[model samples]
Target chain A: MRTEAGPPVTVVVGAGLVGASIGHALTGAGWRVHLVDAVPSHAMVAAGLGAGTAEPAEPSEVGLVVVAVPPRTIADVVGESLQTYPYATVTDVGSVKAGVLDALWERPVDLTRYVGSHPMAGSHHSGPVTADGDLFVDRTWVVTPHRKSAEASTARVVELVRACRARLVTLDVDDHDAAVARVSHLPHLVSVLMAGHLTDVPEEDLVLAGQGLRDVTRIAGGDPGLWQQIVRANATAVLRELRQVAVSLDRLITAVETAPTDEAPADLSLSRELERGVDGTRRIPGKHGSAAVPYEQVVVAIPDEPGALARLFGDVEAAGVNVEDIAIEHDASRQVGYLTLSVQPERAEGLAVVMRDGGWTVV
Target chain B: MRTEAGPPVTVVVGAGLVGASIGHALTGAGWRVHLVDAVPSHAMVAAGLGAGTAEPAEPSEVGLVVVAVPPRTIADVVGESLQTYPYATVTDVGSVKAGVLDALWERPVDLTRYVGSHPMAGSHHSGPVTADGDLFVDRTWVVTPHRKSAEASTARVVELVRACRARLVTLDVDDHDAAVARVSHLPHLVSVLMAGHLTDVPEEDLVLAGQGLRDVTRIAGGDPGLWQQIVRANATAVLRELRQVAVSLDRLITAVETAPTDEAPADLSLSRELERGVDGTRRIPGKHGSAAVPYEQVVVAIPDEPGALARLFGDVEAAGVNVEDIAIEHDASRQVGYLTLSVQPERAEGLAVVMRDGGWTVV
Candidate 1:
């Protein structure tokens, strides 16, 4: 392996949201980036958005080539990128790593030059228009390199992750697939299945939806074509999780069906399932990848004006409290919105007092 | 039926979040309000928070008695309230209207004075301390009065809904149950089941969760005890939906299992299911009860400082654009946040320009 001087030159193929975002991040990090896409306009659009120049990389000149394509095409694209740029270490940012690696294994491609990676970051919106340079910041980027993969190739991908400011998690192909199936793919399908029931619901009934329904179905709004491919590519792992979920659903159904009509006794099985849900939720990592810490939420009523939130944050800062997270609750017809601020438990009381003293209603 | 005069006196039983909120709203609307709870301290706290006076209503003096109890006890509370306040109309705000009404039918209580109502409003936080006077403003209040309910009783409940500034949707008991089963109960279970899967997830994998998982599992964090009662009360309807979902999952699992290894063709059933999900998501009512309208989202980068949101909103107001909705996205370790502003499609470009010109990053 030869060491290159100055900023690394990286090429990003497939100019969709992830690809364009990678290009944008790499360009911002002083890496010379070249972008390509099957649809030439997508590459041009991504380039125009300052992601990179819409030019193919010269042979042996590129240090790394990142293939960000649909799951079905990942292996093909990664193989082509590897063969096309002999000197560059190749990586693909596809959701399903095992299938792609297996597909490549079946081919005559050089496995030593390639690594499979997936950045666990995305937006509801797609396309280059929604591509953001800082999209990968603080996100986990999982790299799955097989036994045949060269150490130099894996190091090159790690360099790419560093340039994008994403945390790195090294997992084998099967583990990456299983982890994503449990965390991402399974949840996506669950959201889709839940939202699917809404198709025939009356408009009047749907008008009664609250934040809970919104949260449950929000990801169901993703492009169907993209999700179909993802689900198909990770079919084995996703099927395993789906089967587990189906069994759980059946158990819950039976628990509900056999529940006493007239409150004979507490439904132990039903309560146990709900308790398990609480346990599951508690397992989700809080900010900074720490164990999920229950934060004290302080609800403040803000006038529906432009500067109200800004002013509230100002007051929160003045009170020496850090706002960990916030959610805004507003109705179209209401002139006031409630801003729920999640903060450290110890800081909540003081912040509430400060806000209340500053003439804000804190509940 | 006797008509009452001069700002109708209302009594709210069960001083939890919903009941206290109703009390607060009614008191603010010029009603003589009284609050009661099985737990005396809960009523006292709600009263001290200015929701209402912690006193029982005099016989024949209360114009309306609102029973906001657990679903299992709703019928009993509503029946007792109706008997105690002989001249007053009574309503219960249990989630499952049909179950409560059926429980009432099994009793000797008069049905003419009682109405089954549910306000489709809530927050993740529970209890009286989290109550707010405007909680029901712009929310749908479903009144599921049976055939035996008197016109006067239904009208009185409508008046209460009006006083709270909530939109009213009148449905028969069975229809209300079915509608909620499709929209609310089923989604809640899906969220719970999805969250339940996370119980055994490794912390390293849990850190990979994104917004999709967050949204899907958010409501799973609700009080399990409360949810257990709710699920049990609506078991019949919820079970029906659960069975349908289980079938869908089974079908999806089969489709994935039988999928072509070499991507010969897309799994027709899998694609169709996902397409149905897209259709379903589009059917959800948007702001102001309109059909879901796709809004153009403009991303604005805000400095991680106090008043950043306020300044952004101020600039947005200065641009004379009404933000349809806004979401704040920030990483725990990041010093900047992305505020995704949803606006009228035509207004998005102009707002982006205005934001960019105002020294904000618009993507």
Candidate 2:
């Protein structure tokens, strides 16, 4: 059995968000990392952008190889690497596992040293410009190991994921596609559809679109090329889920058209619909595989200044409060900002009371 | 012209999230607030739940009455209110306007004393229990008036909204409905459709749902009764937008099915699709009717403890930087938490540098 000792040698392919992040994480953990990309200039980009690297060499020299290329290119990149160097246990960080696995099936490579992976972590921003070393520090990293995948190889990949401070989740290729379709892919489609509708709005009317719309449709602004590949790869499941959404929307249309009156239903009221929304939403995973955490709010008044919020936070800290999440709204005309602090449930009321006593206009 | 003093006597009907919040806001601003509802027991429940009082005599002497009842009942309530009580300027806060305006059209009362308003602020959390005195602060409160509405009556309602510290936008009834359909109703439909898809998930699989899914579908958990009223009231525009969304989703589905392999069209890649998504998303209005603010993230490491996060905030403040938004993630098993601070563009790098130098791990 190989002993877990000093930093392992990790090689990450593709100098983008996923790849660089892996390298950055491994390097931060004291690992000897060699990042590779098809573009020779990628080594410099990756190193300078902070994921770390060197020239690619024999795979046998490294403990693991993480393929972080595009979905369309993942198979080719993994296959090529395996063809040239055969000793390292290889894994991939592709969004769609089945497609990559299917493409790699016919390749003349060692089957034992290969595993399929997808770290369910991303940002609204993309490419190296948005690269950060801690991108996967506390996110879920999914590993899809087929029946033929060697146990040792799977364990090694899981170790690498854990070393990067990510929670490990095991699944089959098909299940991964289906699960991600429901959670990630379907949301993107919904966002895109809503965003497409906005295009039809008259410019003047469109100007009134607010935070609610922006928050709901935020994911619409994703990389189209990348999303096309993901949707195409996972089309069957995405389409199946999209059909379900269509049916739900159709029922809503019918119900709205036939409502007893314009007033909300007395019993099933809008609250019930919203409750269902909340229930389903809670089923989502939270920080590092924990259950989803709902937001709790605390309203604080802030003066208009460069560091007003920093001062408010400092004041909240002085009052012995821990803020879990925060949202800020500024009224430029009034020259003030409303800071909404989302804390743990038990702490919310206490913090609010404390902030109130602290005299920062705790709203 | 009349000289205005401090707060006016205000009456709120229904005592729900909207009504109670209005009452609380008005009362906080030094107004004599009279809250009324159909059920006497509801008043106790409302006040106990944080909504406010429901005294009948309060409306008898008030200068303005805000009917916060459901859309369907607004017409009957407003019609009766206008004929029954002739002393005060009258207003109603309903999602839809055309119906309410139609109900009031033939009333043998002073139309000059009536104005219609809808505050574009709400919570998935309903009723008096979640009533916040500052709920409308910094949010848009749309004031819709008929062509014959008296300027003084309109000003009265506008003053109330202003006192609540909300931004005011004046529009005709039809314009309000159309605007809300694009910004509010359509988003609700999309959220509901997406959340309803959760019904199809295998129970075991859904237990693994994560924050991304919850974020996109959170609004789906809205009050079905309120949504029903809202959708029915704005049926035409909601249906039109839904059809538009359906068409766009269908196109996306088609693209997924027929897009070429590695030879994908220039704009068909997922990355490209996501880029378009971002572009369209940026079009939504943000604070001050400006472009939506995108965050610059600063990830910091915190120890797991009650006062750890508070202390971090203290240090963040000492760094002399303002945090625009914040998200925290705690890895229980690891005994550490990752706190992400969203700061203005120029401050992120400087703050990160300072936090790191201050002996804290800033990623």
Candidate 3:
């Protein structure tokens, strides 16, 4: 991503969200990024957005080549990039890894220059137009280097992650696939299945929907064609996780079907499933790889007017609390709304006191 | 809940989050609220939070009695409230309406005054301490009036919902349960199943977790005991939804299990499922019960210093864009982070220009 002379020279193949994001970040850092794509307009569009310039004549100058393409085509693209860009370290932004490695097993390519990496950062929104240079900042980026990968090449991939301002997590290629299957791919399909239930539901019935259903279904809006490739690419690991989920579903179904209207069974499998979910959430690492810190919200009634949020948040800043997040409970028809400021658990009371004394209603 | 001469008088029983929230909302509307609970200390805490005063002896003066007890106890408490408070319209905020109505069928109490309501607003944060009067503002509150419910009683319940500033959706008791089964109960279980998959996963593997996983599993952390009661109370409808989800899960599992690593089948059931998911998300009503508006995010990189957010958002407001929501991406060790401002899709470009012109880095 960066070089000793001016900036790193690299070739970004496939001008999509991930690729254009990389190109944008690298160009902003003064890198000479050569953007290329099978669809010529895609590369041109990314270049027009200042992600990078058109493919340069001197391909051998690129110190690194990032293959950002569809999962089904990643191996072929990576293979071609390695063959075409001699002396360059080759990496990719593919979500899944083992399939690419399996596809590359018999290919007559130099494996020493190849290191596989997956930036855990992504959005349901796709295409170059949705790209942002800061998308990967502070996000966990998993780098997987196979046994045949040279140490120098892996280091280069590591630098790519660091240059993007992303946190790096290293694992073997197969381990990366399995971990992503459970953490990313499995949860994705879970979202998809839940959303599938919604397609046939009556629209009038949807008024009952709240934040919970919205949260559970939000990621189901990702491009279906791309997801089809991802699911198929990581089929083995994904299938393993999916089967386990199937087991839980059957158990929960039985629990609900036989549940008595008068009283819950003494041995409540339903409660057990809900409890297990709590434990599962606990397993997710918090920011900076720490235990998840639970933040509490201090709801304040903010008048529906301009500059209201600024004045309120200014007071929150004056209270000397680092607001972790904020949510505005809004409706088109409401004149008064609530703004929930998420702060450290221990600081909520002090912040609430300051706001209340400052002529604010702390709900 | 309000009367002509003074604020309307009402009794809110069960001082949990929902109950205390009702007490808080009603009290803020200038109504005299009486809070009671099986655990008297809970009622006292809610009273301490200014939700209401402790229950008074003269309950007959109240126009409405809100039974906010647990689902299993809702029938008994509601029946008792009707018997105790003559001339008061009795309603309960049990999530499942059918079970409560079924339980009240053989009671000697006057069924004429009883109505079932479910306020869709909630948080994983529990207890009276987490209650806010604005919690129900703009939230959909369903009023389920059975055949036995009198118009006067239903009107009083609707007034309670209005007093809380909640949007009202009236349905038959059975229809209410069925709708909630699809929209609320089913999604809850899907989240539970997804989160349950994480429970046994290695902590190291969880480093790959992202916002999508956090969102999908969030409601899974709700009180297991309460969820157990809710699932049992709405068993029949929930069982039907669960059976269908199980069917979808089976189909999805089959698709993934047989997905060839080399090439996908001509008839891609996987893609079909993903497409179905996209269609389902379209069904979710957006703000003010309209079609979900696709908000676009304009990410800006901001220095990690106090007052940066206040100033940045101040400009956003000045730029004539209403921020639908905001998210800050942070890690323990970053000096700079990204703040994504969500705006109407059409206004994104204009906001970005205004931001950049104002010396902000619109990434």
Q: Each prediction's Cα RMSD?
A: 2.9, 4.4, 3.7
C-alpha local distance difference test of each model: 0.81, 0.71, 0.82
Model 3 chain B: lowest-lDDT 10 consecutive positions: B121-130
The better candidate by TM-score, 1 or 3, is: 1
lDDT tens per residue, model 3, B271-312: 788999989988887765666787888888787666777888
Please give the lDDT score at residue B284 for candidate 2: 68
Q: Residues A1-363, candidate 1, lDDT per residue (tens digit)?
A: 336686667888899889999989989988899999999999999999999999777767888888988777888888888788878889999888888888888787788999889887774545325788888886778888898999988988998989899888899999888888898899999998988878767776676676678779988878888888888888888988998898898888887887664576867888888888878888877656666788888888887665566567667777877677788765434456678887888888888889999999776
User: Whole-model lDDT, candidate 1?
Assistant: 0.81
Assign candidate 3 its CAPRI class: medium
Q: Which candidate leads in lDDT? A: 3
TM-score for each predicted model, relative to the true structure: 0.92, 0.86, 0.90
* Tens digit of per-residue lDDT, candidate 3, span A92-183: 99999988888887899998999999987655434324677877777778899998999989988888898888888899988888988988
* Higher-TM-score candidate of 2 and 3: 3
**Winner of 2 and 3 under DockQ:** 3
In candidate 1, list every pair of residues with a backbone clash.
A310-B310
Which candidate leads the pack in DockQ?
A: 1
Rank all candidate structures by their TM-score, best first, as comma-separated numbers: 1, 3, 2
Interface RMSD of 1: 2.4
Compute DockQ for each candidate against the true complex.
0.59, 0.40, 0.58
> Where's the lowest-lDDT run of ten residues in candidate 3 chain A?
A121-130
